[model samples]
Target: MLIFLQERRLPLSLCGWQMRNRLIYLPISSITEWFAIPMVNLRVISLAAPFVLCTSLFALSLVQAQSLPTKKKSDISAPAPQAKTVSLSNIPHAVATAFCETYPNAALVSATWVERNAETCIKLHTSEGTKTRDLLYRLSGELIEMAETISPIALPEAVKETIHEEFSRAEILSAKRLVSAAPTLYEVTLSFGAEKETLIYDAKGVLVRKVEHLPRAVQKAFEAQYPRAEILAFSKQDEDGFVRWVIESREGQSHREIVYAETGEVVAISERLFPIDLPEAIKETLAESFSGSTLITAKRLTQVQYHISVSDSSGNTMLALDATGKLLDMDAQSEHVLLSLATSPAPSQDLKAEEDAIAPIPVALPDPEVDLAVALKPIKVEEPLAAIAAEKKERPVIIVRRYYAPSLGWIPPIMRLWRPSWWW
Candidate 1:
């Protein structure tokens, strides 16, 4: 069969398979057969054919070389990466609070986004509070432009474009340096373990705050970190020059207060609650749970109202107390939860756009005691300090506690603890 196929012009079908796979094969032994046809008159034909064949082969070689491996490019010269862009710039409520508290100058006084025929003017705060300005700019990558009083710097576009093209840098490292030197108004936010720290800046390129977010997850995880310490309240202190935070903790037989500087690091001292006079069992529990604190406050948390406050280097914890001395819940976090719980009866399904539209403009937020010293004035004390000191000395040294469980947001304490009363 092989001899028959080879001898009688039999088709071996080599070209058929070769065409399917697009592979070409050259036979070295066959070259001489074509030359044999040429000897008859073929000086010109022979010379031209050899040159043409060689040129075709050279062309094939070029194509094959192009099909193989490629060269490496230096990523070092590439542009910095950008964040996943978002349209709505929702400044966190906490960040808003912190901004207003720390640098009242940079606060957003009012925001008006024209909706329909009427301009919807949302006043950030009323009653001569913080001064604020909001601005818009065209931003690309790390380069920001179109600056108003509140906008970032305005440089020539060519300079900026040249910088972008020629300047290769680790944007992350650059950001770290910038953040270390000053706070950034991030295009987005970040969540750390149980807490969410959202960073924001003012027009002056100053970090306004690492605004803390307390989610349910954070509150629940709080116990795991400090098993003995209970967070009586999370405070947002609006100092004249800086923002501060304090965590009120209770330990066995004593209470401790830990204050954090603006950077969220403890800048001050940890005070111990002193001269414990609570029931022995309560004292023992406190001793087991907390170190005593110098600062203390009486809090009166009734179903209606409560004021949970923690003091400072003043060496006093002055909280208002009712007959049964249960600590009050007057901090922003508590008030937020209460207000939410109170209005939650009407579900989202019941809410309509028309109803929201018809709703009256929201009342301005009362200033946070937060900066209570600035926002509220201390009542005039006519009594002499000696007498006041005597009264405080005679009063029982007790740190009152109030437990808040979201499950029981609607329930009030059935009974209260009793303590010695003072003659106001």
Candidate 2:
């Protein structure tokens, strides 16, 4: 610290130092009394006078300039926290405007707010026909990515071939394509026995990774229940904590979906049974009605209802039946089901050729703004639209009951003479 001694008029020799300037270099420790300028005893002042000097010529440069160093540039690795979700009304005008300008017709199914690397993003789920697309946008309303559902069959030939060769026994249950700033990849879920495996494949069809595993007990139970049936597919029902296993035995026609609890207990069972699984009574009833006929296939609609397709020398016939093995008339509305199955071609015996041509069916893509109400809807909720036209041709049967007058069996003499073969 620098301080000026108070005895300015004193001669330098009397002050004990002949300094050019009356400044003193005192250690911060000895400067308590010098904080306030005051008259000091000459004897006391003179004792410290020998240290005086001009600060500008000496101490000024000794005081080092100190400040915090500029903070290092931010790390690219630390991702930003996710953005908070807000109501549609809370969306920024710029973002909303950009979205509207880009996808004017998008039918919004849902939306969410997310942040990546400090950038505010709006993720939207827009329904287009039977497909839903996920759209990502920046705060400025710039479209970042537009990812829609893509059928596995629509994947590049290389990708499909790779999957088929690698998992030939595994059937693809669902697939989706993600197109972002990076290279495109397909996410596919395949069913192998009771296990569902998910894999990511590059555009060229290289496998990237697998997803997860299930309880061994659950898998064992599924295999046990459907010993002969090939595992068609499987999915987890998170809401109920149950796993659904789709099993099929006869080509791809017979299907059975069994839901098992996490503990391996049966939760529910719904199977599409073939003709061979029909109750004895039901089989006998069909035999009596359509003699010398072969059962081609049978679809069990419920515990009691069945749609039986039989082929006789004349042609194929469809029979509706109840659980008690009694014939039931098809409902007027369900008449189309019979008509469709009747006209549908029977499965070709050349399974190898049919299997070779298996392809993924793509969902119809519609404009974002199009209304789903105007889209073609299935008249039968239980029937898949894709297979309806195919099923219509080969499985034909409309059993219309023919009512006959009771007196015709023992026709009155007068009526017998006039009765024609068709009339009687």
Candidate 3:
């Protein structure tokens, strides 16, 4: 730097320099100040200035680099923060006009401000009837994700195809939507176009299952064993946190219900069909996986997972740890869990595959506009919508009660006087 500076000027009178750290500012226009200080040799000044100039240039460049956007998950890794949220009230009429025009058929039931932004998260109930085509829209007057209403019977074929295509023969025993303003993925039924099929999606939008349908390849293997068997529409339930599809297969009119764990591949196809006498391979596998877990209870699936309960030495139940002792239950248990936990021992109560896929399976979500800067802010609350078709699920009777006396079943004639005719 000194050599360069000297070249730029010339072999002139030596002007001494004073530096604050590495600053090379020369005190000029003051002979007294200059003469008072000994001249720093041009050679030394050159060596020192180079380091100062380089460091200063680099520091300046770093400050500028900070202004550029850092890597966003949306761009590389997982989905980053949403775009800026715009309030519905604040959206221009043109945008509102576009929404109204776009989703004219969709019934707008409720709207809430998501991310405290411009777009409104709208809920729409598209039910053909009490039992047919019930859907929950996550539409914020825009095309986003959608979820199926719980116990939505007579599901539309279009929505059903979306599920089949997505989960594609995957047994979607259950699904749910994690809390999100505009979730990229859903935990509940997968949808394409207007149709929906019961399917659970990971937070990353990976498809896990469809109701009663295991992955196609796995189903084919199961089918090979039961050649003439046809599936009698089955009901799915969570047996120890796994989505177990209790399939009723009929061959030549002989029908029997068989439970199969839902999974993409045959991770652990059961060896025995009869009431499972704990297999040594399975028991040791669970013990080794849940190293410190205390085996609590064990239930058997015909061909898949052994639902067992084991808790840590500390007494906290080990709910969904894998065969390797890894606590893998981060999200709500879907029927898809049957596969992931196949080899692991259930060390607690048989967890049900989550029926309510999520708090609310959002359908038709808003175009995400979450500003990365403001993602940490609390999400605003919306008024709860009336549950139109929330089917009541009856808990299975674990213990049967025997009636001791006939009079206990109903009040005797003497107590009938208190019971009004209307009550009867």
lDDT of residue 413 for candidate 1: 33
Model 3 lDDT per residue over 193-246, tens place: 555465545444355554544555437656877778765344555645555544
Task: Report, for every candidate in turn, its global Cα lDDT versus the true structure.
Answer: 0.41, 0.63, 0.46
Best candidate, lDDT: 2
lDDT tens readout by residue for model 2, 206-229: 887665455677778776766666
Candidate 1: where are CA atoms >4 Å away?
A: 1-32, 35-151, 154-208, 213-326, 329-424
Better candidate number, 1 or 3, judged by lDDT: 3
Q: How much lDDT does candidate 2 score?
A: 0.63
Clashes of 2: 13
Rate residue 98 of model 1 by lDDT. 45
Candidate 3 overall Cα lDDT vs. reference? Answer: 0.46
